[model samples]
Target: MSQFVLHDELWWVSEFSCESCGTRLCEHAGPGAAPDDVRQALLAAHGSVTLRPTGPAPGLVPVLRALREASGVSLPQARELAAELVRDGLAGTPAEMGLLRDALHRRGVPADVQS
Candidate 1:
């Protein structure tokens, strides 16, 4: 139910992802370098179609900054870490959070137990 906009030589409305990252700018081309091709490729690979404009969203910038600060990492480093977690399948699905919690417990990191 979320919405996103793909804008290049033209614009289209679709679902949202981290589109503002320029990862899907040329995703819709059947076989060319147009931003549309990039958009389609992104959807096929990452499962989203909404293209974000080429800049950080005003509000999200500060929030991301805070997360990075708290984690003691730069924004790019934090993003890379998250991406690695996803790629390595170390992250859990929403439904799998409970299972992940149990696994974490077995590893001695009890949930809600605080540091």
Candidate 2:
């Protein structure tokens, strides 16, 4: 199972359990993307949502900062993400997209989440 958790910052956890043996193990993540397998599972099960920037171009600086604060991506990664936002926006789980939408809003960038 994979779950999203909110703490001082956002986090994610995945767990495995054995029904017969009653054994369990879990993994936790910091404030950023979940593991690739976990994310893939979620997308396969629930589909993906996209965030689209609306109105005039918001510029690269605000988008870079939004990606940095919301996803904790490195500066170079943020730059790439910013480009994607201007080009086609970004896609992820609803929660992930919402996090970015709000971050962009806070930076005065107009954007919306699309299901």
Which residues of candidate 2, in runs, are more than 4 Å off? 3-8, 21-25, 29-32
Clash totals in order: 16, 0
Ten contiguous residues with the weakest lDDT in model 2? 1-10
TM-score of decoy 1: 0.20
The CA lDDT of each predicted structure is 0.34, 0.79
Candidate 1, residues 4-74, lDDT tens digits: the string is 22221122233334656844332232321224454554445545221112222234344344334433468
Query: Counting only residues 3 or more apart in sequence or on different chains, how many pairs clash (N, Cα, C under 3 Å) in candidate 2?
Result: 0
Q: Cα miss at 13, model 1 (Å)? A: 52
Q: Could you tell me how far off, in angstroms, the CA of residue 38 lies in candidate 2 after the best superposition?
A: 1.2
**Cα error of candidate 1 at position 18, Å:** 54
Model 2 RMSD in angstroms: 2.5
